[model samples]
Target: MNVSLILIILLVGAFATYLAGDKLASKVALLFSIASLGFSIVLLNQYNLGENINFINQWINQPNVSFALNADGLAIAMLLLTTALTPIIIYSSFRNEYKNAKSFYALILFMAFAMCGTFLAADGLLYYIFWELALIPIYFIALIWGNGDVEERKKAVVKFFIYTLAGSLFMLVAFIYLYQKAGSFLIQDLYNLNLTASEQLWIFLAFFLAYAIKIPIIPFHTWQANVYQKAPTVGTMLLSGIMLKMGLYSVIRWQLPIAPLAAKEYMYIFIGLGIAGVIYGSIVALRQRDLKKLLAYSSLAHVGLIAAGSYTLTIDGLRGAVLQMIAHGFVVVGLFFASEIIYRRYETRVIAEMGGIRSQAVKFASLFMILVLASVALPTTFNFVGEFTVLYSLSQINVWFAVLGGTTIILGAYYMLKMYQHVMLGETNTKPFADVTFNEATTLVIIVAVLFFFGMYPKPITDLITPSLENIITQINRIN
Candidate 1:
C-alpha cells in the first residue's frame, strides 16, 4: 500500500505544479517527478525482498469494483519506467518557454499520474478508469498547443481522440463481460474466469481493438504520424515514449491472461498482423520526408516487433517485449527531442531542408548519431539487447516471422542513416548552426549515458521483470 505513495506524489505534484503558477511550475514539477523516481527505486529495493505494495479502498458496489493498486515485479518495472521518464521529460522541456506554463506542466504531471495508475491498478474498473483518465490531458496538450495549421491540428487531434476513445468503448464492453462472469472487477478474479471458447474469442477481440489502436498495429496506425507531426515536441515525446506502451502492457497484463484460450487460438493471426506492421511501417518510414513523421513510422516498426514478441507467449518473448518497451521508450524520446532541438535552430522539419549541421554542432551531431544508431539496434546500445531478444522470440515462433520482423534492422538503418547523412553530414548548412546549450546537452547526455549503460549491462532490468513474466506465461499456458 505504501507504493500508493508513488501515485500520491505524482497527483499532488500535478496540483502543486498548477498552483505554483507560471514562474515555478516547471521547477516544482521537476522536483516532484524526481521525488517520485526516488520513491519508486526504494520500492524496487523492497520488492527484491519478497515484498509488494497494494492499496485498496471500497468504492463501487453494484459492479463490485474497488479502488485498488498493487506493485508487483511487472507493475513496479512499468512504474519505474513511468516515473523514470517523467523527470527526464520535464527536464527536456526546461529550455522551451511554453505559453501558460502552469497548465502545460501540470498536464504533464497529470499524465504521469494517470499512466502510473494504469500501471499499478489491480482492479479491472480502476485500471479502465485510469486508462481513460490518461487520454484527457494529452488531448488538451495537443489541441491547445499543437503546431501546423489550426484546422489541420483540429482534424488530427479529433481523429486521434475519437480513434482511441472508440477503441476504449469496446474494451469497456469486454470488462463488463468479465465483471458479469467473475462477479468482481479484480484482475486476478477475471483471470480465473471459466469462460467458453467463443466468449474468450469475443473478449479477446474487444480488448485487441482497444489496445491495437493504442499500440496501433498496421492499419489502425493512421492517427500516429499526423499527431506526432502536429503536436508540440513534448506531447510527441509523451505519446511515443510512454503512452503507446500502455496498450502493449495491457496485452501482457489484461488481454492475454483474461482470454488465454482466444489468444492461443488466434496467436498466429495476431502475431502475423504485428509482423506485418513491422514490415509496413519500416517500408513507409523509408519514404517519409518529414523528421517527426519519419520517426513516428520508425516507432511503429519498433513497437510492432515488440508486440510480436509479446504475442509469442514464451519467457524469452515476454521478457524481450518488456525490455524493448523500456528501450524504445528512452530512444524514441531522445530521437524526437533531437528533432525538436534541430527545429529550434532551423525552424523546419523537412529532411531535404536540413544538411550538414555537424560542421557547427559536433557534440549534437555525435549524440544524434548515437541515438540514430541505437534506433537501428546497433551493438553496444541498449536497443540491441531488446531487438535481439524479440527477434529470437519470433524466431522461436517461426523463423520466417523473425526474418520478416528483422527487416527493421535493415530498413531502420537505411532511413536513419539517410537521415543522419542529410541532416548532419555532407555540405554544411549555409546558416550558422549553434551547438547544444547546457540544458539541451544535459538532456542528451543523460539519454545517451542510460542507453550505453544498460546496453552493456542489462541483467538488472531483465532480472527484475522475469519473475512476473514467468508467472504470466504460466497463467497463459494453463489454458492449454
Candidate 2:
C-alpha cells in the first residue's frame, strides 16, 4: 500500500512517453492513468478502516517537517476520485490535436501526482507544498490550451491563479502559527494543541478564507465562471471534478477539528453564507447563456450545500456532504463533457446556437437528459441520494434552513431543463449535426453507467465514508 510508489510510476511513465514522441504522448498518458487507477483500487482493497497510514522521512530540519504522507477513509475516497477521472479526461481530449502533445500529457500526469499528494500528505507543510503544486500544471494547461478571446482567457487564468494563491497565503500563515505553537507541522500534532478561543478564532478564519475561496463560495466565486468558461474541457473537468474537492476535504480534515470551539461558535455564520451562496448561485445560473458558465454557477450552488452540510456538525450531515462531494464531482464532469461534445459539433457554446440536436443524436440527447436530471437531484440518481441526505440532516438542525437550501433543486431543474430544451429539443434550424463519435460515445456511456450504478448502489461509498465521519464528529464533540 505504498501510494507514493504509484505516483512515482505515473510520473516516470509520463516522462518516458514525452521522449517517445507527440504521436504516442496521449497513449502514454492513458496508460499511466489506467495503471494509476488500478493501483488506487488495490490500495483501497488493502486499507483498514479507522487506521492512519503514514510514510515519513525528514525533509527540513529547521522547520521540523518531513515528507509525510498518510491516508484514512476520506483520503482514500479522494484518491479514488483523482485516479478515476484522469484517464477519462485524457481520453476525452485525444481527438483534439496539440502542438506540444508530450508536454501537455506530461502536465496532466503531473497534476494527478499533485492531487494525490494533496490528499495524502500528513504534515501541514507537506500539504501546503502539494496544495500549491496542484495549481502550476493547471495554470499552464489553461493558459496554453484554453479558448475564447485570447486576452480574456489569459486574464481569467491569471485571476484564478492570483485569487487562489492569495487565499493560500492566509492558510500558510495559519500553518506557521500552529507550527510555532505546537513545534511540529504534523496534522495530528496540531490537532492535539490546546489553543485559546481567540487564537482558534483567528486560525479558523485564516483557514476558512483559504478553503472558501478555493471552493469559491459566493463573493469569492467571481473568478470561477470565467475560468471554467475559458479553460479547455479537460482543464475544466479537473478543476470541477477533483480540484475543488481539495478545499472541501481540507475543511473536514484540517479546519474543523483543529479549531472546534471556533467552528462551533461560528457555525451559524458559515452555514448562513453557504445558504446564501446556494440560492444566489442558482439564480445566477438560471440567467447564464453560455453552457460552461451555467455549469460553473451550478457547481457553486452544489458546493454551498456541501459547506452547509459540514457546518451542521451532525454525523449524517457530514456523511451526506462527503457523498455529495463525490457525487457532484462525477455529475458536473459529465455535464461539462456533454457540453463539450455539443460544442465540438456546433462550434458554439451559446445556448441559442443549439437546437434540435435530439433529432439527430438520440444517444447524446438521452445521456444529456439523464445527466441533467441527475444534476437537478431527480430520484434514482446519485445526486438525489446525496441531496436528500443533506437536506434531511439539515432538517434536524432547522427546518427553515433545509427549505432554503432545498430551493436549489427547483432552481437547478429550472436552469438545467431550460438549457436542455434550448440545446437538445427544438425546431430544426440548421443542418443535422453528426452523431457522437465512438470515443465520445464511450466516454459518455461510462459516465452514464457510473452515475446509474452509484445512484442504485450508494451503500458501498456511504459505508466507506461513515466511519471517518463518525471519528471526525466524535473529535468535534469532545472539544466542544
- Each model's lDDT: 0.92, 0.89
Instruction: Report residue 354 deviation for candidate 2 (angstroms).
Output: 0.7
Tens digit per residue, CA lDDT, model 2, 2-85: 767777867787687788789999998999899999988887777754333557889999989988887678888888888998
Prediction 2 TM-score vs. true: 0.97
Off by over 4 Å in 2: 48-53
- Model 1, residue 398: distance off in Å is 0.8
What digit string (tens of lDDT, one per residue) describes model 1 on residues 1-480? 388899889999999999999999999999999999999998999888877567888898886988888788889889988998899999998988889999999999999999999999999989999999999999999999889999999999999999999999999999988888889999888878888999989999999999999998977999999999999999999999999999999999999988899888888999999999999999899899999999999999999999999999989999999999999999999999999999999899998888889988999999999999999999989999999999999999899999998999998999899989999988876678899999999999998998999999999999888988988988898743
Q: Clashing pairs in model 2?
A: none
The list of candidate 1 runs beyond 4 A from truth reads: none
Model 1, residue 417: what's the lDDT? Answer: 95
User: What's model 2's lDDT at 24?
Assistant: 93
Can you give the TM-score per candidate against the true fold? 0.99, 0.97
